[model samples]
Target: MNISVNSLNMPLLECFGSETRVRMIELLSRQPMNIKELADALQLSSAIITKHIQKLEENGIVGTESISGTRGRRKVCYLIPDSIVLQLKAPEPPEEHGGSGYAVSIPVGQYERCSVKPTCGLASENGVIGMVDDPRYFSDPEHVKAKHLWFASGFIEYRIPNYLVGRQTVTSFSLSLELCSEAPGYNEHWPSDITFSLGDTVLGTWTCPGDFGSTPGVHTPKWWKLGTQHGLLKTVTVDERGTYLDGVRLSGLTSADLAIGPGRELLFRIACPDTAEHPGGVSLFGRHFGNYDQEIEVRIGYE
Candidate 1:
């Protein structure tokens, strides 16, 4: 998460001021803990720890969920974000497509084609789309309602809706989505090489650092419990220069290579090849599923 240095963010900035809070962060980093456990570990009263946990929750560093226990309901605390990025200043803007561009939000389950392996499944906010780990479920009619999906290997392809009119030259296009490596439950160290492509043009491969379940995603549903919670938001863009992943150059493939013309359909693919050195797998979180509440966003610029 990126937080800029500004007066408006003083409260969040001050989250690190107290040593107690720092210790709280440290303990929670190891694993989720309840009020009594944290209090006992810190040698403080449960009431005191509750106050600290409240502060952490207010600052968005910690999250608390009420669960049943032998005695009664207990509040369990979990870290929120795997990492934080402090931005003293704004970053350089990515190369824009053109003066005029349109953005589209495509659902994660709206894939036009897919080839997947086990440890694969898709779920809507309401429930699982079909039987988990069954490839045939990917073809289920209900798959389009999925808000989250993962696969051990193979690829999912989507058709980007082209809004270009006659003679409107395609200048650039970009796709933004939340992604992470796929693990059985959760693993902070698991890595996967995920590739992005536009039709036949291989945009590039990005190494997902982990399956990331260290904390609950900001927008993840509490009732939905498995292991994986969120992922890093990645944006792949193809412009005049080349293809870029989150503003970092990923390959030499340019917009021309995408062959995005006026009438031609745009097929974008996210893949985790079984041949990759780190064949950890791939997981995608869509709106109401990941840290960032968003769908597979597409921005198409035309002149």
Candidate 2:
């Protein structure tokens, strides 16, 4: 069967293609300013500024509002949109596109009941399972604070979309996820057997059993300790050749043999089965970390 695919697309910026408008955007990014202020900063005539501003406003890039002063007067100023994310309007798919879809399932809530018992440290705002020698903060509602400890018998499940799977002739498929060890203070020595599954088939496994060393986590609460070793595990690439951590590849793998996108939506699942004597757990960082959990994005950019 032949499968057709298209590239990802995002909104187009009307002013983005124009050099004058682009310069105005750069200056406005620094701070909000009125038309006169923008004209003065750009050293452009008011007429020119007004023309560009009109276009920008029409394109939803600039906004204007009135500010009232203590005196019986008000002022009008313009500002750039608070946020701007560029994307393709209709990205074209790979020239050679044919295959099945990919799937992923994660059991995130299951770990809530699991527990870990060790002499190690723990950090939390609600209660203490281990011990957090540092201060704890949960000031932001968007924050996700966890003080969890567990042994070799738990896992989180995630499900990928079936549409992502591609052709049988595909050489390699990458499965990326955000990961880091769960530790307090500092732990550069923690490793665990992390397993991956495609439906019921064991695609492969990796040992995450060790402290991630001392890397800062964005979502990790501010009041908590800093410089705690945490590996921002991402961009994991896998194929018939072998599995990989980030970009570094490993042996014992087969991409051609696995029916990733041949039709039956391929589902990939990760787990830390209790069977492994040495197990490591991971803490997922999300928005509160000043990063996006969904940021651990996956896309089959294939050949």
Name the best candidate (by TM-score). 1
lDDT of 1 by residue, 100-200 (tens): 67777899999999999989999898888889889999999999999999999999999988776667767788788888899998775688999988888
The number of the candidate with the highest lDDT is 1
lDDT, residue 282, model 1? 94
Off by over 4 Å in 1: 1-99
Tens-place lDDT digits, model 2, residues 174-228: 6555444544443444556766666676756666534432333434555654434
* Model 2 spans with C-alpha error above 4 angstroms: 1-152, 164-171, 183-186, 212-215, 223-229, 240-242, 290-294, 301-303
The deviation in Å at residue 220 for candidate 1 is 1.4
TM-score of each: 0.71, 0.44
